[model samples]
Target chain A: MSLSLENVSAGYAGRPVLSGLDLAEVPSGSIVALVGANGAGKSTLLRGIAGLGEAKGRIVLDGQDISELPPEMLVGRIGYLPQALPQGSSLIAYEAVMSAVRAARPDSPRAGGAAAIEQVFDTLGLRDLAMRRLRELSGGQRQMVGLAQVLVRKPRLLLLDEPTSALDLRWQLTVLETVRRMADAEGAICVIAIHDINLALRFCDRLVVLGGGGVLSSGPPATALDADVLRRAYGIEARVEACSRGFAIVLADHALSLDHHSP
Target chain B: MTRHLTALQERSASLADLYGGFIRNRLIAIGLLAVGLACSLVLDVATGPSGLPVADILTGLLDRDALPRGQAVILWNIRLPYAVMAVLVGAALGLAGAEMQTVLNNPLASPFTLGVSAAATLGAALAMALEPDVPGLDETWLIPLSAFACAMAATLLIQTLAGRFGAGTDTVVLFGIAMLFAMNALLWLVQYVASTDALQQMVFWTMGSLARATWEKVAVVALVLAACVPLSMRSVWAMTALRGGDDHARSFGIPVERLRLRVLLRVSLLSAAAVAFVGTIGFIGLVGPHIARLTLGEDHRFYLPGSALAGALLLSLASIASKNLVPGLILPVGIVTSLVGIPLFMALILTQGRRP
Candidate 1:
């Protein structure tokens, strides 16, 4: 029910993007926000845990090392959703999600009854669009369908790589709310890479700020997302504030002073 | 509560029917194409050099002893075997083309896109030119064996390229096209250096004739086709996941590269069996999948068999055209396939309302 990454290094083609990154225990029934600048190994870290990248190190889930597990073994417990949605599929949203459900359990009988796919569809407010082909759906709708694919698996450890990048405001809130509800209700450990600081601070139970290919600060959002960490990680001078209702938020007023190096 | 029960029953019934409808529609398409192939088989048998009487052919099929000796030889020896080869070869090419397109995620991908047929042609031409009587490779089977080996070699090269440079779209297709051009150049070089008789044999092999069909050859190809197809059906579900794209397939735990490797090997075997028997018969491997996609969509459960049947129908009909198109002479089935396939392909594109 708890997830811990001691030291993980991963990259593409032997060039390490994330170098010895570490995150302490993330307890069950919590949302951990992962925020970092571009090329700070956000997606790579998520993919590495899913056994998709060239990763080396122990990723202990409830004290069991999953780093060396084969893809088929690791896949049953971990679910990772990438940033870009798959394109040009003629399958309807319902069929697409059903296919994923079947694929996630290749050994079992295709026990994901139509109701399972339909339940996810209805939960995401996609009942009206369930039968629509994936290629025909808009970006936001496709992103929602992608989340349904992962949620259908009901993995113990969930990783979302910028899940809200293409979502509209209402659906974005709905999706994050669903993630939190799944965490609290199902006791799943969820880590989401996000760009929106206010939503992350408000919804997430803990924050892990990534910088220089590793965690720059780690604590509750109020303690970890200070001006120093924001300047170091995002290279922007920012301030953390609380709204009148006491929900935390981040406001960036100017770009921080830094040496710019162009390749 | 009773009202709710009825609604739930109706909803679940409709859900079952949704899947049932998919299988039913695919079966109907297969049935229609199967009937068309049956008709083409009859035409192929009835309209030959020494055309057998249709009444006698039918009666002979029902009772082998009912056929007169001359008519029996023509029906059993020449036309029946040729007709069977046409369908089996067509089906093999069609299935290979369907899998190739699915793996590459390119609608235009064909069995020949990876240079399998071209490599086979080059291998066959080399066998004719050099007459390498490789031991254990039967003299009669040398050309085909050589061709199959060469086609498999091309597949291996593409597999290596795919492994080295990511297995996503365009890597294998680009490498295959490169091999195609290179093989064509090599095939021409072999043709240039050959003597008159060897050159004639090589040229005729590339033109793709059904005149070489025999009962034994038909049975061998049929056996290969039979073994290749059912094995492919097992992978149809994984291939279905692939239609959503490699990343999507992988996320669902489908091994994309491994699936591609296995399917590509199956494709090589199918295409090599086909062209080895009939030379480089064109169009079936290119258009069969398109016909299937347009008919059954991208689901490989139906798409694979649908493609196979459509290819069978096209090639069987083309075999008939090869005989009837010229009153005095039977043109090469390869030439007739292009003559028939181009128009059929154009109609499919026009009716499908999409640019190919």
Candidate 2:
């Protein structure tokens, strides 16, 4: 199975943020990191793919044009986690996840739903927090619950917008590792809009970097990330060095001149 | 590895058991609320000024001929309608408030937040001031009839505006607040030019009373609420998702905008039916959902019914208080609700502030 985007233009309020974007054959069972600076339309692209925002063009998943499908048709098939964590709900985490499962797939039998929710809570290692109200959970814990909400659906295409923005280092790794496992085990296509480039490099199979309202580069992280790409995309002079364990690590030097840059 | 698997299985079993217990507890709470509501209804019907005995109230409810002729007439016509109307109107407002609060993502958003009550008040004021002469229309019935019409009109206007300017919480809430202010200003203007007698009537109507409740009005509110509760329950999971916020709800493939619009429409219907018949009974709409949330949590399965039951209980108790507040003078039910509800609402808010 593969996902492809052709000449996609996504934006808010009829203003194009990402225009004429294309990606060929994003095979299933792969994790792709969507990395870019702020205002780089990383979120717009994700929202566009998730069909939560306006987009014009073709997003084909598994030989079907998913972009044309109704939002309800995307349930349990295209899971999205917004940048903001779930908040202020008096519902317990268990009920929150169970409700998501029931909402997305109302026709599914209740017995199966209970087991599915239990499995997700087990997978997230949040069984202890399951009975706690969302408002009682910390930011990281709530973020985890939000992740559990999407993960319980077990979508074919997971679109996460800054899922780890509020999480600490260990929790961030836990999230990415869970995504990686989903891609490998379930063949889910995971595209994460993330700011932590090093974490992305370490965890993701491929990096789809955006700059200047378009794709800057798309390849395996080791090949796609470099000094030139970093300078152009993020307006920073940085070094792409291999760590002792042969992992790519970015070492930033200084900010490049941004006088003429619109990004 | 064998021990790890066993541990995993055991933990899953425990979690599943915990979830079962949680659901059972919520159901029990709902059952308790229902029982409480039933008791309040009985108490409301029993505690009236005519000095009817509780045994007579019970016997009259079961067998109309058990009471003396005048007592039977009072029980069946006055006490029964009043008590039943309290429960129905309270349930309507409570369920409407619960949906409004969830869809708007605002704890303070009650049925009146959309200006239905305000518009109803304006209609009542106009009816009092103008005293429109319609052929064959009862002079006393004009106020509630006009109020119901104006409330429905405001609902349509709000619905149109929601469709026009995307039904996000902010747009709907801001427009509703704007409508509320506009209606209040119009009501004041109408009251300013009215005769002293009309002014007095307007003031009394704004305070809201169940004194005018008849079997017909009771049926109207009951019919609307009966239609609404099932519809609210149908959207329970979607509303539950909405508590996670719009984006979270949308991600679950729940159309958040459309759901908000539909909920707003339903809430408008329930609130209009309630406030039109009963006048502007405040606090029940705001406090009912909070009480439900405190007792039953935000699972709309429980929350919706819990809110409805809580509202019914609160109003039923308030109805009893309205009758007994003074020795011979029955204070307006709305006055009792406000006087009792304000402290309860404040306490809930303060306790909520201490939570994460």
RMSD (Å) per prediction: 3.6, 2.8
Question: For candidate 2, lDDT tens digit of each residue in A202-244?
Answer: 9888899998999999999989989889988998989999999
Question: What is the number of backbone collisions in each predicted candidate, taken in the order shown?
Answer: 0, 0
Q: How well does candidate 2 reproduce the true complex, by DockQ?
A: 0.69
Tens digits of lDDT, candidate 1, B286-322: 8888888877777677889989998888898888888
Question: Model 2, A175: alpha-carbon shift in Å?
Answer: 1.6
Candidate 1 chain A lDDT trough over 10 residues, lowest sum: A254-263
C-alpha-based local distance difference test score of model 2: 0.88
lDDT of 2 by residue, B28-99 (tens): 999999999988888888787767777888899899998899999998999989999999999998999999
Query: TM-score, each model?
Result: 0.91, 0.96
Q: Name the lDDT of candidate 1.
A: 0.83
Q: How many backbone clashes can be found in candidate 1?
A: 0
Would candidate 2 be rated incorrect, acceptable, medium or high by CAPRI criteria?
medium
Best by TM-score: 2
Put down candidate 1 lDDT per residue, A1-263, tens digits, no spaces: 89888788878878898877788898999899988888887788887877777888888888888855676767777778878666566666766677676766755665567777767766777766665677778888888988998888888888998999998899999999999888999999999999888889999988988878778998898788888888888877788988898987888988856573111
lDDT at B256 for candidate 1?
89
